[model samples]
Target: MTKRVVHYINQFYAGIGGEEKADTKPFKEDGPKGPGLGLNGPLEDAEIVGTVVCGDSYFNENIDTALPEVLEMIKSYEPDLVIAGPAFNAGRYGMAAGAVASEVITELGIPAVTGMYEENPGKEMYSKTAYIVPTGNSAASMRKAIPAISGLVNKILAGEDVTPDKDGYFPRHRQNYQAEERGSLRAVNMLIKKLNGEEFTTEYPMPEFDNVDPAPALKDLKNATIALVTSGGVVPEGNPDHIESSSASKFGAYNIEGVKNFKDGYESAHGGYDTTYADEDADRVLPLDILREKEEAGEIGKVYNTFFTTVGNGTAVASARQYGEEIANQLKEDGVDAVILTST
Candidate 1:
């Protein structure tokens, strides 16, 4: 019998709209929409019985409500396997895909698979819970992603043991028994190769490190301007920018000129922590009040009028680095001599 597959995709893939329509609720389509069409031939012996489309923002933002509703939809189809997006590196989309696949596997007791970029926050969070095939950083890799995911799905449906290296999925760090040269002998061989300056691959590779030299201390704090930056997600109440609560795609800049404290109309958008205190007094997270007091006492020259904020929870390093560079450039242009960055 042919295996039945239930496919999930986001609004963008469903031809609804991009970020603007990202709050669309979950809905179902017949079979093979968007990338699902490409998955058809590759998914041998399996047919995409239905396609479930959802908005990335909606799924991540309303996970508790959306997940069960989506699961019920998938369950109605009675699929043998559930396939979520090859979400690439889109943080929200990847997270949604990972979450859907996980729910299908755990709640519905069905096999599920999803795909994403290696560095996508979703891969780190859900790889162990669902089979996640690695794709490139964008949907431009859809062609490659579909085939890899479909091939893995075939293996999984066939009851074949699919290993990460062999199946192009992210490693879940599952230990497997393998016959190989003894560890001591392997170590000696590696050492011999190193001593002889011969090419050798270590069984374990050391992680690369990013080294940053610290800047010299401010020569005159009384005359140097300082700015505030934070990944704590503190923002004016109602969040004008719609900055995501998790896996934030954009950073916000707010004017604090002549402002003494974060009183009413200020709160945290970060979804990872308790918002009670931050909501009551956002100054606890950004500390603009304390900085202002210091400036008044001549402990610092001045506080820059603008502060940068973004949610750090589950945000991709690449996105963070981009935000950092942009924020730094803005600060430099404003003649800010130093910055205080906070996180939550």
Candidate 2:
């Protein structure tokens, strides 16, 4: 028996405009469109009967309304399965795809699948809600994404076990099957393998997180090169970089070569916390005032010429990680040996 499927894609994938047209609302059409066309041919056990198109911005910004409308459209198709975009690294698109897939699976009790980069905010938001196949950072991986998605769909309809590792998909962070051995036995086996320097996979894998080992302490604070990095969204007056108050897509490096404190004109771009206090005294967030005091007292080395800043309010983990890496690289190049990182 063939499984009926519904395909979802953002504006760009449907021959619609990009950011400018992102306000387009939910719409539907018969048969597959865009990436779905490629996916349709490869799916052996499923047939895409309808395509639901929604703009990325519209879906995300108006999710309260747009999601229901989109879900209604998908429900009209009465699909046995739903396949959303291989949204790649486009944050908004990835989020929309994940949202659609999640709704279909949880709300409608239908199998839903999508593809996106591992770092996609969608994967972070909806990995447990949907079966997501991994893809490259951009649509350049369309060829690869389509096939991977198709494979998952085929296996899903055939009632095959779609493991994340053996098959190529993000872990759903769910385990519903029984294990052959008890938890303690598996743990002991894993420990033994670790002791012998052998490879052993954990029965229950934990979520991914940065396990940064502490760096050796700076032996000489008086001679150390200290730098300030913040996700507190503090910025110079006027926010020249136009860094967002939330979900900041970029970071700014301001020249503080002569700046001793933030007294004259600095403010917080962060939206997660009260901006009044931060705007009134940006040093409260970045703590440059204290650092300056320590420098003047010769308790610590000079503050680096530049300070890194970004708004962490609602920022995706992937974006934050990227910003941190970039900032670290620049500081390393400048021979900055120590950093004081602040966050809201």
Number of the top-ranking candidate, with TM-score as the measure: 1
Residue-by-residue lDDT tens digits, candidate 1, 215-269: 9999999999999899999998899998999889899999988888897789999
lDDT of 2 by residue, 238-315 (tens): 999877665567899999987888867899877668789888888888888999899999998888989999987656
Clashing pairs in 1: none
Steric clashes per prediction: 0, 0
Report how far off residue 320 is in candidate 1 (Å). Answer: 1.0
Candidate 2 stretches with Cα past 4 Å from truth are 1-4, 15-31, 45-50, 53-62, 90-92, 158-167, 173-201, 206-225, 236-248, 256-281, 293-302, 311-321, 335-337
Candidate 2 accuracy as lDDT: 0.87
Candidate 1 Cα misplacement greater than 4 A, ranges:
178-185, 194-209
How far out, in Å, is residue 23 in model 2? 5.8
- The candidate maximizing lDDT is 1
Q: lDDT of all the models against the reference?
A: 0.89, 0.87
